[model samples]
Target: MNLYYSFGTVLLLLAITAPTALLFGYGGAMATRSGVAPLRWFGKSYIAIVRGVPDIAFFLFFVIALDQGFEYLRHKIKCPDWNEPIRQGSDFVVCTAAKLPLGNAPQWQHETYGFMLAVLTFAIVFGAFAGNVLFGAMRAVPKAQLETAEAYGMTRRQVTRRVLIPQMWVYALPGLSNLWMVLIKATPLLFLLGVEDIVYWARELGGTKTPNFTAYPHGDWRMWYFLGLLVFYLAFTKLSEVVLSRIMARLTHGQATAGGEAQRKAAA
Candidate 1:
C-alpha cells in the first residue's frame, strides 16, 4: 500500500505540474509579444537564456543557487548578532534551523521538496519552447480581424479577449501539442532532481547487486526500465494528439479560416 501510494503521488505531481508549466510557458510567450520594450526584452531574454543552456546544467545551477539563496537570507535574519562566514571550504553551513527539509525531517518531506524543485525546473525550461510557439501563433492572428473588432467599437483589450486570443489557439495548437510531447519525454529528468520517481525506484528495486533487493532482481536491467519509460511517453504523446485534434476541430468549426472552410465545404 505504501509503495503504490508513493508512486501515485509522484504521478499526480507530474500531472498537475506539467500543465502549470505549460501555463507559465504560455504566459511567457505572451509577455515576449508585448509592445512595451522592457517587458518584451525581459520575456525574450528569459526564453533565449533558458533555451540556450543545457537542461541538466540549468537544473544543477538553479537548484544549488536557489538553495544557497534561501539559506543566505535565513542566515542574515536569524543570526543578525552573530557573524560567521557562510562559505567555508566550498560548503554552505548554516544554523540547524535553516536547513530546507531539515536534518531530521521525515523522508517524505525531502521528497516533496525535491518534487517542487523539479516542477520549477521543468516549467522554466519548457516555457522557452512554449514561448517560441505562442509568439509565432500570436503573430499569425489576422490583422483584419482586429480591425473588424475595432469597427464594432471594441477596445484593444476587448479585441484581444474576444477575437485574437480565441483565434490564436488554432494556430498555436500544432506547436503547443508538439511542446506537450516534449514535456512528457522530459519527465524522466525528475530522477536527476532526486525525486524517487518510477525511474529511481525501478533501478533501486530492479538492480541485482543490492543484497536486500526484492525477488525481482535481475542483472543489468537498466535498459528494460528505460524502455518501459519510452513506451509510456509514446502512449502519452498519442493520447495528447487525439485530444488536440478534437480541440482544433471544435475551435475551427465556425471560423472563416482554412480549416473551418474545409469543414464547411465538406459538409456541403
Candidate 2:
C-alpha cells in the first residue's frame, strides 16, 4: 500500500529533480565563465560553498534556513502590524498567513510542500557537481573552433550558442552520466526531509512496533526491506547506464573524440 505508493514518490522526485538541477548547474557554470566580475565570483562562491558542505548537513540545515527565511520575509510583508520579535527564547513565531502551505493547509498541501523543499535541496546540492562538470566541458570545446566562429564575425554570444554549446555536449555527457547515477543513489535522502518516501515506509513497516507494525507484528524484517531497495537501485543504475551510453554514442557520432573514431572504424 504505502510502500507501493512510495515507489512512485521516489520516481517523481527524481523526475523533477534531475532537470531542475541541470538548469541550476547550467546557470552556475555560465555564471562562473561570465565576463563580468560579479557574476563569476557569485558562481565560484556557489560552487565552492555548496560543494564543500556534506549533503546531509546541507539538507538538514538548508531546509530549515530556507523555510525560516521565507517565513521571515512573509512575516514582514503579511504580519507588518505585529509588534513582537519573531525570535523569542528559541521560539520563532509568525502570522498564520506567513506559514508555508499555511497552518491550516490540507494534509496533501503539507506533504506537497515538504516534497518541493526536498526537491529543491536535492537540486542545489547536486547542481554544484554538475556545474563543475559542465564548466570543464565548456572549456573542453576546442579553442580553434571558437576562434573560427569568431573570425566569421560571430559575436561572443553567437559563438557560444553556435559553436561552443553544440560541441560541449560530447565532452559533458560522460560526466553528466556519472552525475545522474549519483543523483539516483542520493534519492534516499528524501527520508531525512520527512517526505515519507520509500525508505521511510520501509523503516515504518519493518519496525517492531505499530504503523503496520501491529497488523503484522513482524520481527525485524528491515533486512529484507533494505535488500529490496538494494535490488531496485542496482537495476535502475544498470538501466541508466545503458541509456546514457547510447546517448554518449549519439553525441559522439562523427565527432573528433575517441568514441567517434571508434564508431567510424567499426563502420569502415
Candidate 3:
C-alpha cells in the first residue's frame, strides 16, 4: 500500500511540475526577447547557467542552498536576539522557530516541505531548457506575419499576442514534447530530493529482510518491484507520445509547415 501511494506521489509531482516549469519557461523566453537590455541579459544568463550545470549537481546543491536560504531568512525574522553565528565550521545552526517544518513538526509536514522544494528545483532546471526551446520558437515565427500585423495597424503587443504567440506553438510543440518525455523520465530523481517516491519505496519494500522483519521473508524482490516501475514508465511514455502526436497534428493543421502540408495532402 505504501508503494502504491508512492506511485501517486510521482504522478502528483509530474502534474504539478509540468505546468509550473512551462510558466517559468514562458517568462524566461519573454525576458530573453525583451526590449530592455537588463531583462534580456537576465533571461539569457538564466538559460545559459542552468542549462550548463549538471542536473544532479544542481539538484543536490540547489536544494540545500534553497533550504538554507529559507531558514536563514526565518532565523533573522524569528530570532533577531540570538547572537550565535549561523555558520559553525561545517554545520548550519538556526533557531528552532527558523526550521521549515520545524524540528517538532509532524512527519507529514517535513515530507510536504521536501516535496515542495523538489518541485521548485525541478521547475527551475527544466524551465531553462524549455525557455531555450521557446526562444527559438518565438524567433521561428515568420517576420512577415509581424509586418503584416503592423501593416494592419496592430500594435507590437497586439502583433505578439495575436500573430507571434499563436504561430510559435506549432514550431515549439515538437521540442516541448521531447522535454516532457525527459521530465517524465527524470521523476525517479525525486528519491534524491528526499521525497519518498516510487523508486525509494521500491527499494525499501523490495529488500529481502524487512526493517521490521516481516512474517514472509522473500529473497531480493527488488527485481520484481523495479520491473513494475519499468512497465509503469513505459506505459506512461507511450501514452505521452500518443498524446503529443495528436497535439502536434492539431497545431500543425493549416500551418505553413511541412507537417501541415502533409496533413492537408492526406485530407485531400
Candidate 4:
C-alpha cells in the first residue's frame, strides 16, 4: 500500500541524511578548529546561525530559498535574453530550460527533486548541531595525549589523525546519540517539505470521508493511524538506544573516560 511504502520513504531519508549531515558536521568542526582565521570564523558563524534559528522556520524558508537560488543561477545561464525581474511580486518565473526537473518531466522526477531538497534541508540544520557537538568533543580530548604524541616526533597532522580524531568520538557519542533521536522525531517534517512521508499518508488514508470518488469510505480513524505512528517512533527510539549503548561500550573500552574505567572494572 501507499501508506506502507511511505515507511520506506522515512527510513531512506534517515539513511541518506545521517551520513551527509555527519560529513557536513565534520567539515564544520574541522573548520572551526582550523588555524586559518577566516575558516574558523566561517565555521563558527555557520554553527551559530543555523543552530540559533528555529528549525521549523528554516524548513519553511530555506527550501524555497534554495530552490529559487538554483533556478536563479540556471536562469542566468539558460535565459540571458529574458530580462524580466525574477521577483515579480511573489512569483519566481524562469525559462523552461532552467526549470529544475524541466516542465514536462515525469511525476517521479518532481517527487525526487522534492525529496532531495528535504534531505539537504535536514542535513544542513542537523549538521550545525553535530558540528557544535564535535567541536566540544575535540576540545575534551586530553591535552596530555597530544603532548605525548608530539614528544614522540609525530607531526601536528599526524597527532590529529591518529590521536585526536580517534579519541574525540568517545566524548562525542552521547551528543551524537541524542542528535540521532532528534533526527528520528524530525522525520515527520518531511510533510512540510512537500514529501509525502508517513504523516501525510496517515492523514490522507485515515480520514473518514472519501474524496468525491473513492472505492472505500471509513469512519474517522485519524486517531488510530497516528497512534500507529507513535508506536513506530517509540520502537525506533528504543532500538536506537540499545544500539548506541552497545557502541558506547565498545568505544569506551580501554579509553581513559569514566565509561572506559567502568568497563575495565567489569572486565577485571
Clashing pairs in 1: none
- Candidate 4: which stretches are off by over 4 Å? 210-212
TM-score of each: 0.84, 0.95, 0.94, 0.95
TM-score of 3: 0.94
The local distance difference test score of model 3 is 0.92
Provide the global lDDT of candidate 4 against the true structure: 0.93
When summed lDDT is taken over every stretch of 10 residues in candidate 2, the lowest stretch is 209-218
Clashing pairs in 4: none
Among these predicted structures, which one has the highest lDDT? 4
TM-score of 4: 0.95
lDDT of 1 by residue, 1-268 (tens): 4435545755676687667777877788778877889988988998889888787898778777777877788877877765678788988888877788788999878877877777777777777788788888888998988899999999877987899888888888888878777776676677777777777766765466554655554587777766776786678778888998898899889888899999999999
lDDT of 4 at 224: 97
Candidate 2 lDDT tens digits, 80-196: 899988899999999898999798888999999888888988888888889999999999988999999999999999998999998898889899999999999999988999899
| lDDT of candidates 1 onward, in order | 0.78, 0.91, 0.92, 0.93
Model 3 RMSD vs true structure = 1.7
Q: What is the Cα-based lDDT of residue 166 in candidate 3?
A: 88
| Counted clashes in each candidate structure | 0, 0, 0, 0
